[model samples]
Target: MKVCLVGSSGGHLTHLYMLKPFWKEKDRFWVTFEKEDARSLLEGEKMYPCYFPTNRNIKNLIRNTFVAWKVLRKEKPDLIISSGAAVSVPFFYLGKLLGAKLIYIEVFDRIDKPTLSGKMVYPIVDKFIVQWEEEKKVYPKAVNLGSIF
Candidate 1:
């Protein structure tokens, strides 16, 4: 199955990298904000750029929508997965619009609280997965899969 993994750099990319072994031979596409770590770790994969900000920026959101549109058209992935920090929000929406299963893995950092991106995308995702049981209280529907690591 085709998979599109989207997220910000750092812990989000770390989570997706753990799933890489299970994705052998699948048409896998990765989308993340450019970072030194992701660049070194995910070299040569079909990747896209997303601007991730510490704070919400309206201009970046508009640009991200257009970027997602182009990628969704090209990839048409069967599944879209993310360990998010806002960068994946557009791609997850694209996955839904294109009728692909969307899985949102809550960031490992938010072991106690739901992330802003997680809260925004949770209700629409096919699977809402959290690494911590405490988070399950906030998102009753989430699958407690331990740390995606």
Candidate 2:
């Protein structure tokens, strides 16, 4: 099935890269901010660049929304799997509205705690995959699928 992996750099991208090989046999794409990390790991697939967030705060959400609007209209993948930051937020909303299955993998960083985005998107996700079992305490509905990597 066609899939889009949406996430930021650093840990999020690191984790998603681990699952890249599996998606290669099918139509797969990656969406990220302005960063070379995804480019270095992925080859010959579609990619969308969301405006990089400078503060890692709400301000970037607006910019990402615009980027998401463009991507969803073009790619319109059957499913969206994200190990996220700001970029995935817009995609999640768009995916839900567009009737696409949205699977969100809470980043591996919050091994002991949870992130703001994780908390917000937890209940909305069609399938919430968490790297750590402890994450389920915060989001009881999440499936503690041992890391995709």
Candidate 3:
């Protein structure tokens, strides 16, 4: 199946990368910041840069919404997965409207409380995966998948 993997740079990007076992054989592309690390790690892979400084930034959020619209329209991925900071919001919301199955992996570090991105997408995601069992208390419907780390 075609897949779109979206996440913020750094740790969030690393979290998604660690899922290579699942995505390695699939047709996939990445959505993330155009930072040096992301550039180096995603070399020879298809990637679309999203607007950043996305934490509580209204302007970038609006810009990323447009980016999401354009990319999702073009890729038409059957699945969209993320372990996020903020950039996952626009893509998850728009991808759902377009009928893509969504999976949101709550970051491994968050053992108790929900991350902002997790809270935003939980209600709509096809599967909400939590790294720690404790997180299930915060996200009642979340599946306890242990650590993706």
Candidate 4:
């Protein structure tokens, strides 16, 4: 299966990277910030840089929406996954419309409250995974997969 892994550069990126066992053999690519950590971590992987400072930033959100359209159209991944801050929004929404399955893993740090991006994509995601059992209270349908780390 083709997968599109999308997340922010730091903790979010690390979160997704921890799932390497699951994605290692798949035809996959990444969509993340063009930052040092991301660049270093994804060394030889196929990656597409998206606009950043996405939290509450209308300009970047709009720009990322276009980027999302372009990338999703070109890649046509069968699944899209993310543990996010903000960068996942455009990609998830657009990917869903393109008929890709979506999975959103709420950051491990958040136990009770829902993140902005998590809340935005919750209704549309095919699976909502939570690292902590308590998180299930926030995202009622989230599957408690313990922690990726």
Candidate 5:
């Protein structure tokens, strides 16, 4: 299966990386920030750099959405997964629209609250995974996977 793993750098990326066992053998590529850690950790893996300043930057969000649309069109992945920040919003929606199975993993750090990106994509995703049980209360449809760490 062709998988497109999308996430921001840092913790979000870390969580996504923890699923290497599942994705390592799959036909996969990443969409993430161009950070030193990301470059180092993902060395030898296929990747596409996403736009920065995605928290609330309307301009970059629009730009990234367009980029995501184009990439999704070309890659035509069967599945798209992410442990997210704001950068994931566009890809989640676009991937769903393009008939890709969308999986959103709630960041491991958020125990008591839902992330903005999680809330945005929850209703649309095929699977919503949360690391902590408390998060399940916030995202009732989410499955508690007991942490990816």
Candidate 6:
């Protein structure tokens, strides 16, 4: 399957990278920030860098959305999976609109409260996975996948 892995930099990217074993062999590419960690970890891999200042930044969000539209149109991934921050928002909607299955993994750190990205994409995703069981209270439809760490 053609897969598009989307996530922000730092911890969000780290958590998604843990699932490398799952996507490494598949036809996959990444949508993430161009950070040192992302650069090092994704060396030689196909990736589409996202814009910065994502959280609540309307300017960047609009720019990122345009970028996402282009990428999703060109890649035509069969599935789009994300452990997100802010960059995944545009990709999720565009990917879904293009008929790609959407899977969202809530960040492992947010146990008590739901993340904004998670909540925003929750109702639209095909699958909502949570690392912690307690997260289910916030995202009732989320499946407890017992941590991606």
For model 4, how does the per-residue alpha-carbon lDDT over 59-122 read when each residue is reduced to its tens digit? 9999999999999999999999999979899999999999999999999999999999999999
lDDT of 5 by residue, 1-149 (tens): 99999999988888889999999999999999999999999999999999997998999899899989989999999999998898899998988889999999998889999899999999899999998999989999989989787
> Between 4 and 5, whose TM-score is larger?
4
Q: In candidate 3, what residue range of length 10 has the lowest lDDT sum? A: 140-149
RMSD to true structure for each model, in Å:
1.3, 1.7, 0.5, 0.5, 0.7, 0.8
The better candidate by TM-score, 2 or 4, is 4
Candidate 2 to native Cα RMSD, angstroms: 1.7
Each prediction's TM-score versus the true structure? 0.93, 0.90, 0.99, 0.99, 0.98, 0.97
Candidate 1 lDDT tens digits, 1-149:
89988887887788888886777578898888788998988898988888767338778777888888999898889999888877778888877988989998887778677788898899799999888999999899999988765
Q: Give all candidates' CA lDDT scores.
A: 0.84, 0.78, 0.96, 0.95, 0.92, 0.92
Better of 1 and 3 by lDDT: 3
- Alpha-carbon shift of residue 67 in model 6 (angstroms): 0.6
Once model 6 is optimally superposed onto the true structure by TM-score, how far is the C-alpha of residue 59 displaced, in angstroms? Answer: 0.5
lDDT: worst 10-residue window of model 5: 140-149
lDDT (Cα, 0-100) at 15 in candidate 5: 85
Tell me which residue pairs clash in candidate 2: none
Give the TM-score comparing model 4 with the true structure, all chains together.
0.99
